[model samples]
Target: MGVNISKGFLLVLVGLFAYLSLLLVLPFSQYVLGAILIAYVLYPLQQRLEERVAPPIAAFALVGLAVAGFVVPLVVIVAAIASDARRLLEQVNTDSIQLGELERAIEEQTGQTVDLPSALADAAQNVGTMVLESSTEWFSAITHTLIGLGLAIFLLYYLLKDGSDLLTWMRELTPLPDDVQDDFYQELDEVMWAVLAGHVMIAIIQGTLAGLGLLATGVPNAAFWTAIMIILSLIPLIGSFMVWGPAVIYLFLIEEPLLAVALFVYSMIVVGLSDDYLRPILVDRYAELNPAVIILGVLGGVYAFGVMGLFYGPVVLGALIAVLDVMNDHYDRLADEPGMR
Candidate 1:
């Protein structure tokens, strides 16, 4: 009885500490967690390299390559997109002729005189003023982001270098029985594999199909839109729709009804089919999550944690389910044993 009480007290203390840490160290925790995730994704490659070379050297080389491979393309793509978006916004602001047709259409639809030219001028002025006022804030944000990136890289290096030792330490620290620890590790591995594989495959498929559709329909910024689709596809439900819906509406607004119809059909066939039909099959086969649970987990996670929440949210839910599953199995076995009842 005393031992049980002690264990309960320890559990409560641990929980309280965890809650406090989360509240106090959210920003630092985010960077560390992001680094850990990056390490998790790259660990397999690191392991393979270790088999071929010295472990230390292999880890260093693999982490370096992984960082470059992941970060460089991302930086380039984001910079390009930002440059293009700025240019687009600037062009839209400056080009007075572009608004003439839009104003006429609005006037025709509403049967009211719409002075769009004045509105556009006023908007441009407001944008300029806002940009000037916010320049310092933008620079500060960029500096913060750079600092976060550096911290993430440092965490990732240590994770790759000492991850095994850290796991061993965690195993020792966990209050659960040895059998439960093994089960927990196995379940966590399965969940990570399922999430990483399923989301990546779906993202690639959706991105490719969307890009192809846009290319076929002569949409501007096809690559940029496709990249956006890929990122958004990591979120469950309303994934492809967020990308294609606006494109369709824009095409229709631009008086390209036939092109809009083609885009809509193509998107339905490719994006809709893959998301509705293929994604569930792949995710279920690997993750073993209930469809309803996944939907709720994803939605709840997004609401709570934003983009990273999509990955971490489902992971937490799946981990809890795994723990419960192990407990249920153990209890059933105990019940079935002779004289236990």
Candidate 2:
């Protein structure tokens, strides 16, 4: 009786500590998860580098490359976009642009009065103001930003350098048989590749192609619209249409019907067809995710983890599917065993 009581008390203690530990880590969950994902993506590079250099040196080289190649360009692009948006708002507010012309055109077409200029001005102002405020707020929180960034860097380095040992440790801790664990790892590898290479790479290509179309059609602020298209392209069932669609309407409103028709045709033929053609070469060759899974994952992930959640959401869903598959196999094996029957 006493031994049983001690065991119960011990289990309670473990549970309490586990919950507390989770609470402590919850605030920095984004940084931790971001580091893990980035490390996983860069691991191949790390391996190649380590073949010629030490592990720590390889890890450092990769981190430095990421800072220069990814982080720096991202910061510059965002700053430029924000500046352009502000300028656009100013241009929209100016009387010389004849915003009334578009409103008149719309009213003439639909036989209904619409304050399109005021609505557009209000939207531009809000977007510009929001972006400027966000930039200011981010700069103001320098301490917190630095801390999160430093944590990501530190974690990233260790993961890149010691990922194999970490995998071994996890394998030891997992209670599953070796073959089941191997299957889980294999499924996970394919899914991650699908998310990164399949979804992300395809989005980039599609967005760039749409951007070129925008440029060819002589759309105003093509760079900014291109950036927006790239982001919208990340969402399943919604692609570059959100930006080009408005541009088409605007072109028609401005009496550029020829340009508008050209854009519409180009978008349908080039932009729309790209997915059908490229998806098989990129994603279908590896693993395919159901569109529903990706959609739900993206929505729920963004709600939970902000921008980073986009990648993490689908990954979580993929991991869940893998677990379910493994469980199904386990139960099948159990049913096949004859001792109980």
Using lDDT as the measure, the top candidate is 2
lDDT of 2 by residue, 1-341 (tens): 99999999999999999999999767778888888888998999998998899999999998887667768867867876787678778877465766679779988899989887688899999999999979977786786667887898999999999988999999888766677788889888888988887777777888888888888877877777887888788899898999999999989999999999999999889999998998888887566888888888888999988878888898899999988887787757645653332
Tell me the spans in candidate 1 whose CA falls farther than 4 Å from its real position.
Answer: 1-24, 79-133, 275-285, 331-341
lDDT for each residue of candidate 1 in 1-341, tens digit (9 for 90 to 100): 99999999999999999999888657666666678788898777777776788767767786688778888977977886787677688777555666778888988999988888798799999999999999999999889778877888877877877777888899777756667678778888788767666765677788779877887887777768888888777666657678888899989999999999999999998778877776567777665655456567677877776666667777778888887888786756645563331
RMSD (Cα, Å) for all candidates, in order, is 6.0, 7.2
| Candidate 2 RMSD to the real structure | 7.2
